[model samples]
Target: MKTSILRWLLDPLTSLLALWLWSRDRGRRPYDAVWRLARVTRHPDELLYRVHGHRPDDPGDALP
Candidate 1:
C-alpha cells in the first residue's frame, strides 16, 4: 500500500511532461477542459432539481 501511494505521488511527472508538450502545441489540456466544465455547473441544487424532476410545491408521495 505504501509503495502504491508513493507511485501515485510521483506519477505526476508523466502528466506534467504531457501537459508541457501539449502547451507547445495549440491543443488544450484535459485538466483545463474539466475545470471549465465544472465552473459551468456551479449551481448544484438547480441542476439536481432538473434531473430529478422535483417541483417546489410538489412534495412528492409522503411515506408513513
Candidate 2:
C-alpha cells in the first residue's frame, strides 16, 4: 500500500522530468535518457559498483 502510493505520486513527476531531459538531448530518442535514468534509479548500488569497480563487501561501500 505504501509503495503503491509512493509510485502514484512519483510517476507523473518522473514522466515530466524525463520529458524535460528528452527535450534537452535532441540527438537521442525520447525514451533513451528516461530509460537510462530508470535503470540507474532502480539499481543505484549496481551502478555504483560498476562505476567504482568495488566489491559489495568493501569498506568504502559502507560509507553511506
Candidate 3:
C-alpha cells in the first residue's frame, strides 16, 4: 500500500517539488534528489549504517 501510493502519487509530487526547489535554488538541482533516492533505494542499508556510524564496507556491519 505504501509503495503503491509513493509510486503513483508521491513520486510525481516529489519530482514537481524538486523542480520547484531547483528553480528557486541555484546551488541544487531537481535531479540531485532523484539521484539520491535512486542510490538509497538501491542500498537500503546505507542510510541506516550512516546514521548508526557503521561502516558499510565492513563485513560485520552487514545485516543478516
Candidate 4:
C-alpha cells in the first residue's frame, strides 16, 4: 500500500526528470526516453514486447 503510493507519486517525477535529461542530451526521439525509463522501472517480462505479442527469441524483441 505504501509502496504503491510512493510509486504513484514518484513515477511521474522520475519520467519528467528522465525526459529533461534526454532533451538536454538532444536525443533523437522522445519515445526513446520513455522506453529507457520503462526499462528501469518495469520488469523485463512486463515490457512492451510481451504486451505486443512478440516472442522472447524474436529479433524484434531487442531493446533500442
Best by TM-score: 2
Cand. 3 Cα-lDDT: 0.51
Please list the Cα RMSD from the true structure of every candidate, rounded to 1 decimal place.
14.2, 10.4, 9.8, 8.9
Superposed Cα deviation of residue 18, candidate 3 (Å): 0.3
Best first by TM-score, ranked: 2, 4, 3, 1
Lowest summed-lDDT stretch of 10 residues in model 1?
Answer: 31-40
Per-residue lDDT of candidate 3, residues 1-64 (tens digit): 7643554374665455545555667646445554344435555666653233234668776878
Off by over 4 Å in 4: 1-10, 33-57, 60-64
> Number of clashing residue pairs in every model?
0, 0, 0, 0
Q: Between the candidate structures 3 and 4, which one is better when assessed by lDDT? A: 4
lDDT, residue 10, model 2: 64
Query: Residue 58: error of model 3 in Å?
Result: 11
- Cα lDDT tens digits for candidate 1, 1-64: 6633453376545445444555665575454443223323543444434333223355665534
Q: Per-residue lDDT for 21 in model 2?
A: 71
**Structure candidate 4, residue pairs in collision:** none
Residue 38's lDDT within candidate 2 is 49
Stretches of candidate 2 off by over 4 Å are 1-10, 30-64
